[model samples]
Target chain A: MSLADLTIAEAGKQLRSGQATSVDLLEAVIERASFTEAQLHCYLTIDHEGARKAAESADRELAAGTDRGPLHGIPLALKDNFCTRGMTTTCSSQILAGYVPPYDATVVSRLRSGGAVIVGKTNLDEFAMGSSTENSAFGPTRNPWDPERVPGGSSGGSAAAVAVGSALGGFGSDTGGSIRQPASLCGVVGFKPTYGLVSRYGLVAFASSLDQIGPLARNVGDALTLFEAVAGHDPLDSTSYPGPVPEMRSDLEAGPKGIRVGVVTELSGEGYEPAVSTAMAEMLNRLAADGAELVEVSLPTFELALSCYYLIAPAEASANLARFDGVRYGLRVDGETVEEMMARTRAEGFGPEVIRRILLGTYSLSAGYYDAFYGQANRLRTKLIREIAEVHERVDVLVSPTSPTVAFELGAKTQDPLAMYLSDVCTIPADLAGTPAISVPVGLDHQGLPIGLQVMAPALGEAVMFRMARAVEERAGFTARPAMAGLPT
Target chain B: MPIEIDIAHVARLARLALTPDELDRYRSQLAVILDHAARVQAVDTTGLAPTAHPLGLSNVFRPDEVRPPLDVDEVLSQAPSARDGYFEVPPALEGA
Candidate 1:
């Protein structure tokens, strides 16, 4: 196989056995990325010089008996929202067009320490606001499977890059299925670790409480490898769990035999695409045939998750984003007074979706409306959490389709924000409960787009999630590559 | 349905300067979204406590010790208007 097509584990084996140098692997990926950039628009910035330098240093270290484990010299991509020292972290918004961070985010620092060579920062919805990357200030990232369709987002670029073999694995933050939904659309493995399992320090806040940094990779094993490297406590983020990080890669080969899996009854049928439902049904059957017991489970509050998320995420976002008022940093426009300047700058800087959310949030949190909107949403959230916890008592993990549909055509749902929000219907509950869930490609839709089977586990239940995900990966045998994968280097 | 005037009020509260056309557009769109979001109210959360955070964490205090901060020059470098390591902004007073 070409160097660009190697998974993290495969590339690591090659690097260790003296079969391929890091420089060679890096060059192959750079070539492929350059060739595919015109069609995919997957990245905001490609750090060619920085990656080449890092790869050379990695080669020197490997030859001199200094190794940085599996990630050493592995070419990876980061979602642009992660702060990279001296690199522009625009979050795909014009407001921070030329803004560069003086320090690296904790996840970026951790990846670098593991010797992972970051090739570029991938694009996302402006401030991670939308399910479809169409909300990106830059043009929407095209699905590699079909150029006319969107790569599901706000982590669309990261998922597209990994699917097209531009990067072995990439990092993306999941606020509400941004990572997993895109991963599902792009036929890749996207895992959102438990909320506190991965530190959120330096991730540009989009609903701080719901945001989490996770991995997008070609397979479950590669996803686990990347997850382990970044999942641990960081004192910088007070919400980070102080407990020991679980060894996700230790028991990958173990099958999901005798494991109790709950098929969330509410998530299936009606509103889900017919093809996606079929793929999900086949996956459940396969799991049942493989010695796994499937029990039908229902979280009555599941239907209310999307409604609650819109209120809570936007409310937090409005408060968190108040920091970008053009005084301390980012785009600034002159006005007669400070308030006018702040308003004018924000007017010119933010996109429609962002502004819409801000307005919605401001209204919801306003004095009189708070008790009805934001307050009620929080109460519903509590009920949802309790319902999910009750369901977990009966099943080890909950399963559903990651997204309700496959990659939808660009501009299909952009006109209707509510329709766009429906794309995350199946995946938002996990974020609401702050649980670990993974999306693994199980089959293809009639349109040839990928369908993802979502495996959700309770907080800190990544081990079970991984085992179930691995089993799905093995059974599905979904080796179909995107048509864009054939682009010549 | 949200009144058009209410949309402008919310925009002002958000510190966003929206054009009249945008105000009209958002007034209708936001009403749709708010109507959809209103579905949560029917769930009967009367006795349930609100969960601002899923983790139930509160008062996450850290040691009050001095730590190295970002360089002033580096921080100012990103500002659109910087003067003597300070962010320059519009005058607070109308004519000052």
Candidate 2:
């Protein structure tokens, strides 16, 4: 089998057994990354020399009888938002287009310490603000399933890179549905752990409260492996989890034999394409056939999740993004006066969607509207969390369609922002309630596009979610490769 | 309610400016945005407390401590404009 066909987990075993050297694996990945980047537009920067050096060091360590476990010699990619020392970490925005961090994000530090080879930095929506990669200042990432369709956003490039076998796995950030949505569109496994399970320091905050860094991999096992390496507490991130996470890999293999799966009634569908709904149903049937009990649960507050998210996320974003004023780090446009410079700089720096959110957020926090908008959204959020918690008491996992439909054509809904926002409705509630959720590719739509099945569990219950996801992934048997054949046009 | 969006006011607040035509465009677009957002006004939130965070995590803070400073030259490398040990920018106030 080709090196590209091996998941990170499988490749690690082979590398440790002397079946393949790190140099061999890195060469394959580097070639794939270069080939796929042109057609797929997946990466913002390819760390060819860095990856080679890391791979060489790993080989030396292996030769010296030192092993760094499952991640040793495994090649991977990172979403552009994560900081990498001495590497340009543009969050796909012109504002920080040329800025390189002097330090690494905690996740990057952990992954490197775990011996994972960093292949490249993937493209993303400008500051991770959009559902489609189309909002990227660089350009939209085409869906590996169908070139005309979008590979879902913010983490679209990361998902696309993994789907095309350019990297064994990629790091993606989830705010709303960034990771899951793209995983669904691109036919891969995406996992968002419970909030605080992953560190957010140096992640280039979009909406600090909702953003989470997670993994997009070829399978559930790969996702589990990467998650185990990255999820932990860091003193640098105030939101990092202080408690220890469950042994994810061991639990994922145990399956859902005794687990009770809940199908969220509200998240199922009205606007969801029939193919995706069918795929979700097929997974539920498979789970039932596997001796898992399926129960229908109600989260009545789900209908309000998107509404609550828009208000809360933007409100936080308005505050978080304020640090980008010309006085601090970021692009600055010069004007005759300081105030004029600040105005001109931000005007040129931020995109329309970002500006709209900032304005809405600022207004929502204003005296009159604070109680009306942000206040009400917070109340709705509490109700939603309570409902999710109540449902989790009866079920080990909750299932839904990751998104309403398959990838849409590029620029298809740019004129209708509401239509684009609705794509995240099913996935956003998990973020709102701080739950662990995953999107695993299940089947293909009528047009041969990929569809994703979502599984969610209560906070810190990622193992349960992954267990269900593994079952669906094994049964659904999705093997759609990127249309570009691992090379850019 | 503010019948029309004050483009200059919003632009100043957002650190942006709009031309007359762009102002007209944003006025119309922002109205639709507000119209859609107005749906939040109808939900009844009486007796419910506003949740600042979903995690129920409170007082999540780090101890304030001094750390080693960045190499001044490295820190200043990307600065658009800088003076000795400080970043230089125009100003925050309108007429400062």
lDDT of 1 by residue, A47-84 (tens): 98999999999999999999998899999999999999
- TM-score of model 1 vs. true structure: 0.98
lDDT of 2 by residue, A229-266 (tens): 98888778888878888766666667667789988889
Count clashes in each candidate, considering only residues at least 3 apart in sequence or on different chains. Answer: 0, 8
The TM-score values for the models, in the order shown, are 0.98, 0.96
Q: Judged by DockQ, which candidate is best?
A: 1
Kindly report which residue pairs in candidate 1 clash with one another: none
Query: For model 1, how many clashes?
Result: 0
Error of 2 at A264 (Å): 1.7
Judged by DockQ cut-offs, the docking class of candidate 1 is medium
Worst 10 residues of 2 chain A by lDDT: A480-489
